[model samples]
Structure formats: structure tokens, C-alpha cells
Target chain A: MHDEAVAHEFQYASASHQADTAVAGMWLFLATEVVFFGALFLSWIFARHFNQAGFDAGAERSELEIGTINTVILITGSLVYSLGVVLIEKGKTRAFIMCAAAAWLLGLAFMILKFAIEWRHDLDRHMFPGADFGITGDLAGGAKLFWSFYFFGTFVHGVHLAVGLGLVAWVILRVWQGAFSAAYLAPVLVVGLYWTFVDIVWLILYPLIYLIGRAT
Target chain B: MMRLLRGAFSGSLGTLAALFARLSPGKKEGIGWRVSGLLLTWAVMLILVGIQYGVSRLHFAPGLRPVLLVLSVIMAALAAIVFMEIGKGPGINRLFAVASLLWLLILLGLGSMDPFTRVMYYVHPS
Candidate 1:
């Protein structure tokens, strides 16, 4: 009975130990995510290397300005989320909640910009891979391959961001309910790690999808 | 040139030492400092994106493309280490953190070899 009372399933020897285990778990998950996205990157590299001209053509058609804006927003959102983590660790519950809410808003803004505005523009321009794909000539096939990777990568990334945002909302709700304190902030820290990982993924994606082929 | 390099190296070392001192135990950063750091990261990201766009406009060498990508990755890594505090936990946690990144490098490095080297054959009938 004493052992059962003392050994709660969620209990650790110390708060620090719990935090460490959570961080390790999060990193291991992120590692898998890296390999998951790495496959798409490998496909992109080979496709671009073999068909530089076609890849360049497709890259030129991307919405560079909007993509850049979204990248900036995502990184800034991560920063805000990190700030919330810091505030929570410092025992500033109200401030942490506010910062978390701001971060969530920024994430929502990014999604709206990416899907509603930029993707709609892409569809209008026939950038989507289909019978009506917008490119032509000898480079058409290669360009289609580029668009395929582009849409696939960005769609996967968007889904991840949506999941991160949901997690952020969860953290914010918990903060409002006084579920976190200086002694126990592992949840906030782990969510921040996930948010920053998403941002890192976007950092890689930006140059590949938007910056390439702009020299033309 | 030797003297210049020495001076630059010492300068960087001094800056790093100062940063460590500021972040030493029992001297946690305040909210203001955290806010400033956040803004600084945002500004750095914006500037890097601008530079990338500008470089693309110029007829720069193709090799510069990979270099710019590396630069952005480094920037992102800095944000991860500093802001996300990936290195703040116990020693084993740090090992796990580093291992994850190493595994990613291995995955990408080994995974690309097949696609990069495979030969495709095309047949034409007369």
C-alpha cells in the first residue's frame, strides 16, 4: 500500500528528472520526424539535381513573398512560445498565458496565410500538379515533379504546425487553470521544443521551395 | 594576416566568455532580456531571409545556394539551443538531444546515396 501510494505512474524521483525524461522523449520523437521529412528532402535533391532547368522553372512560379512572410511569422511564433515557457518557469502565470495566446494567434495567422491566401493563389495560377498543371514544354514533367514535392512537403509541414498549435492551445488553457508552476513546467518546455522543431523544419523548406530558381 | 586572425579569435572567445558569465548559475535572465532575445531572433531571421532573396536576384555562383542553406540551418540551431533550452537538462538528456541530430545527419547522408548514384537506362527503337 505504501509503495503504491508512493509510486504514482507519473511520478519521478524529482521534478528535474521528470523534465529530463520528457525532453529526451520529445527529442527522440523529433528525430523520427526528421527522418520522415528527410525522405522528401532527398527526393527534392535528386529531382532538382537531375532536372535543374525544370526545377528552376517550378521554383520560379512559387509565391516567394508570401512564403517568406509565413516563414518569418512561424519563427517569431516560436520565439513567443519560448518566451511563454520562460515566463511559466519564472512563475508568472498570467504573463505566460498572454504570451502563449499570442503565439497561438501567430500560428493561426500563418496557417490562414499559407492555406487561404497563398494556396488559393497557387491553385488560381494552376501550380497544383494535375492535368491542368501550369508548366509546358520539355521541362513540364520535371516541373511537375518539383510541384509534387513542394505540395507534399508543405502539406505535411502544415499538418505538423496545426498539431503544434493545438498543443499550444492546450498549454494556454492549462496555464489559465493554474496547472503549472515554477516547480513543474515540463509540459510547457516540451511543447516549446515541439514548436521550435516545426520552425526549424520550415527554415529548411523556405530556401528549397521559395529561394531556388529565383536567379532566373 | 596572422595577427588579424589571432585578434578575431580572441575577440570571439571574449564574447563567448561574457555570454556564459551572463548566463551562469543563479543569474537567470529576466523577462525583459527574454523579450529582447526573442525580438533579436526575429530580426536576424528577417535579415537572413532578405539576404537570401537579394542573393537570388544577383547572378551569384550556384555553390552559394548550399552555403546560404547552411547559414539558415545554423541560425535555426542557435534558436533551438538558446531559446528551446535543449541543452539545459541532465547529461543523459543532452546525449539524447545530440544523438537525435546525429541520427538525422546519418539518415540524410545514407539515404541520398542511392538516388544520387543510380543510373537510368533509356531505349529507343529504330
Candidate 2:
């Protein structure tokens, strides 16, 4: 959407042009999302710097195991989605739906792990920032800062995953209606790019939050 | 102690590395690069955290602080490059550039508010 007039201008032949436009626009939008998440990363970096010890302490207790499993699960989902894209080109709608379903199920698994397991565990452990955080360390307040970023980062990433799941369902619906074909695979590719980007963000978070403060 | 330390990082990076490594070979030429970039970032950040924690535990000279501090910038760059997929292509390059620039402005604008107040303090000396 760099130029309002440019976006409105449909100067191309066939639906492929529209598809490319959609792909380009989605990519540009993801670029904006990156900038948005970048702000959170900055705030966390600054705050964590000021309170490294506290942040390290907070990082120590985080459920890296659970988070790592979720990371792998999401990656598996991305691969399934990719396979679905490939199958769509060959006109395999049933397989396409299966791949989309796998991605959606994996996403649900991730949410369950993040919310039901990890978040609840943190709450029970009194690790929730600004809520019953009973941290008594050199960087006590900074510990809260760590949790603040941790929770917010994971929460926003989860929202992206939710939207990605929506896209997966949309793909399934379009497949059911025979809306996609070998000639029209842009939608699947576009959503894969988006879902993978979301997964990419979590990839960074997996290490930063859960693995920080480990050993050399 | 062994299990605690090993168990700590074994989950996130270990898992991501394994999964991402398989995706390195794909029909897309740049996908491997993207996955590698993401994996490398997580690996490096894990190292940096280890260094920081180890320093805090030991009686390392206070002077090592400067080196450790510089490491944070490196870690941040890794995260940015991986997430932004910088240098991926002409199309993505422009996107990453604008996105990072915009992020920098917003972050510094909000982050420096407190320090800027201190700068005004010395100038006005109220």
C-alpha cells in the first residue's frame, strides 16, 4: 500500500495478477507487524539490560521444555501447511484439507500448551508480573520486567497464530468450493508465508525467553 | 546442577534447531537461508545468555562488563535479521528496511523519554 493509487490500479491479466498483488500486500503487512513486534523486543532489551540479574532469574524458571515442544510443534505445522500448498497445485483437495487441518490442530496444541500448561504453571509459581509476583531478588522489579515482556511477547505471538489458524480454515473452505487449482496456488503460498513468519517470531522468542541465563 | 543447566536450554533451542534444520532443504531457494538464520540466532542468543549468567556467577573482573554489554547488540541484530529476513530479496529488503527504521523510531522515542528528561534537568537545573 505504498501508493493509494498504485494499489487501486489493477493493471494486469488473469487472476494471477490479483494473486501476486495479494501476496505482495500480505508481505508488506507482515513487514509492518515485524516493526510492531520490534518495539516490544526493544523495550524488553532495555529493561532487561537495566535488570540483567533479575531478568536472568526470571528466565531461569520459565518452562523452556514446554515452549520448545510448542516450537517444534509449530514448525511441524508449517511443514504440513507447505505440503498442503504443494498438493493444492496437483489438485489434491482432500490432502490440502488434511494439511490445513494438521496445521490448525498443531496451532491448537500450541495454544493449549502456552495457556493451559505454561501460563497456569507460571501463575501457580507466582511468576505473573504485576500480579502475585513474589520475587525477592537483587533485580526484583526487573524480574517483573522480564515477565512483562515474556507474557506480552507470547500473547501477541499467540494472536498471530490465531489469525493464521483462521487463514488455514479459509483455505479449507475455498478448497471445498473448488476455488483453488493448479493455476491458482497464490492463496496457499501467501498464507504459508504468513504462518511461517509468525512461527519465525516464536523461534526467536523460544531462545530469548526460555533459554536465556542458561550456561556457556 | 548438570541436569538443571542442561535441561534449561535443551528444550527451546534444541527443539527449534532440530525442526528448522529439516526445513533447510526446500523447493524455495531462500527458505533454507531463512530457517538457518532463525536457527543461528537462537543458537547465538543461547550462547550470550550463557556468557552473561556465567559472568554473574563468577568473580570475573568488573571490566568484562563492556564486552558482555556489546553482546546484547549482537543478539538483538540476530533476532532482527532472522525475523525480518533481511537481504532476502529486492521486495523483502525494502520491507525490512522500512520496518526496522520505523521500529527504531518508536522504540527510541518511547524508551528515551526518561533519559531525555534528565538531559533537560542538567540544562535547566531546576
Candidate 3:
């Protein structure tokens, strides 16, 4: 276990106090992110409300199978990450590293499935929100807007996941160097929170993007 | 043929039962339990996806869409609270977590009111 010494420059009286403050800070940052993503969701809701048929058409054209698979992959990655945290908390470093590696691989798999497979498929279908967009007819404009939102939402989400994967890799390196211990797993826990937050965003996005308009 | 089918079904059930037993909370907390938990989470997510697909196929009343969306939010909240341990921390930490959620709700609620209520300004054919 690492020594219980608090890092210099922290105003907290104890290491645990410092950890608590750090987590609180992370939560505050996440709160801001919630509102950030919330604005996009609100816009989507309005767009769908006004352009129901168009949105439905756009959604029906989406690659539902891939989106569903990616959802499962991301959620499983989050679970693996939480398990890694559990192992770390138990002072089982080797098991923690294994779980972390598994989580990272899952994260990578999600990115590949989304960007390499799904986005390419979308591009082939001309789902991009521009002059080259493929949809035609009376609802073309509205469907174009819907596709715009879809591309923006998923692209931003992918970026966040990429950042999270980087964080996971950094944590793995730290674990390899024996920097983390049962007493100081704050970085791991905080990064896991971010990863899970990304998962939560996808959970919300899954239905909106893939499920809502399928039947029609 | 009937016996073979039944045997296969029972065999799958037995395997599932054994997996659940290994994941039981009272079982020794180790890699097995953790892996089981991960699988259980995956299963729940898959079930939710099934529900989403099934509901979409049902083509329920448009008003029901919000209800279905709420269900997904609840599932995500469960993962957040349980897997992320949002509430399993110091009181202040829990306060921050709860506050973040509360603020998000406020943002969504207030931000949505305008779009929900305001009339669209369509240009007349002048």
C-alpha cells in the first residue's frame, strides 16, 4: 500500500479528505456535462416533436443492430470498469489490472464497432447532414435535420469515450507502476465515474436514436 | 427428438443456475463474482434493449413514448447508483451526486418548456 501521506499543495487536512474533495470536483464537472448534453437532448425532443414523421423515417433508416450491439458493449465495458475498481479496493492489484485491461479492450471494441463499422455504413448510405444527404421527398428537410442531430450526438459521445479510454490507459500504466493502492484509488474511481457517465449518455441516446420510430 | 430438446434446455438452465449461485452475494467475493456481476449487468442491458425493440414494434400511443424513455432513464440510474456507487460515499459526496442529478432535471425541464410551448414561426406565403 502507498504511504498515507497527503500530496503537497492540497488544502485538505487528510488524504481521505483530499480524495473526497477530488470526487466532489469531478461530480461538479459532470454536473456541467449533464447540462451540456441535456441541451442537445432537449433540442432533439423538440425536433422530433415537430417533425414526427420525418424523425421516424430517419430513425428507421438507422443501423439498429449495430447501435444495439454498441450499447451492450459500452455498458459491459462500464461494468468491467466497476469490477476493476472493486478489485483495486480489495488490494488485488493483479486482478484489478486484468479487469482494467478487459474494460479498455471493450472500450476499444465499442469505438471500432461505432466508427469503423457503423459510421462507414452510415456514410455509404449518405446519412451525413449536408448537400449530399440521401433522403428525398417532402420530409427530406426534417429528416436531414434529424440526421444532423444523430451525427453530432454520436460523434460527441465517441469523443468522450475516446477520452475515457485514454484515462483508462493512463490508470493502467499507473497501476503497473504501483502508484495506486487500496488507500488511494481515487483516480481509478473518478475515471470509472466518467466512463459510467458516458454509458449513461448512451443509454439515453439508444432509444432516442434507434428505438423510437422503428415500428412506423 | 423431444427428449433431446428437453435435455438441452435443462442443461442450459442448469448452467444459468450455477452461474447465479457463483454470483450470489454470500459467495466469496472474487473474480467469479465480479465476472458474474458484469454478465448480469449485460443481461439487464440486453433485456432493456429487447424492451425498447418490443415497445417500438407495438406502436403505442405517441404519449407513451415518454413513459418508455423514462424506463431507459431508470435503468441508467440504477447502473449509476449501483455500479458507479453514486450514493455509497460520504454524505457530502452523496449530496454532490444528488445535486448534480437535480440540476440536470432542472436544466432539462426548464429548457424544454420553451420548445414545448412556443408557437412555430412559419413564414406565410406572402
DockQ: which candidate is best?
A: 3
User: In lDDT terms, which candidate is top?
Assistant: 3
Report how far residue B94 has shifted in candidate 1, in Å: 2.8
For each candidate, report its DockQ versus the true two-chain complex: 0.29, 0.12, 0.38
TM-score of chain B of 2: 0.54
Candidate structures ordered by TM-score, highest first: 3, 1, 2
Candidate 1 residue B17 Cα shift, in angstroms, is: 25
- Candidate 2 residue lDDT tens string, A1-216: 123223233575446556666666776777777778767767766775666778777777887667656765666566567656645655667877887898889899899989888999998888888656868757678788888888889999989999998988888888778776565666776787788778767765765676554322
Instruction: Name the 10 consecutive residues with the lowest summed lDDT in model 1 chain B.
Output: B19-28
The regions of model 1 sitting more than 4 angstroms off are A1-11, B1-35, B61-64, B115-125
- In model 1, residue pairs whose N, Cα or C atoms come closer than 3 Å (at least 3 residues apart or on different chains), thus clashing, are none
The CAPRI quality class of candidate 3 comes to acceptable
Each candidate's iRMS in angstroms? 7.3, 6.8, 4.8
Question: Who is ahead in TM-score, 1 or 2?
Answer: 1
Local distance difference test, candidate 3? 0.78
Give the alpha carbon lDDT tens digit for every residue of A101-208 in model 3. Answer: 988997898899889988899999998978888888888877887888899999999999999999999999999898876878888888888989999999899888
lDDT score, residue A116, model 3? 97
- Distance (Å) between predicted and true CA of B124, model 3? 6.4
List lDDT for all candidates, in order: 0.76, 0.66, 0.78
TM-score of each: 0.84, 0.66, 0.86
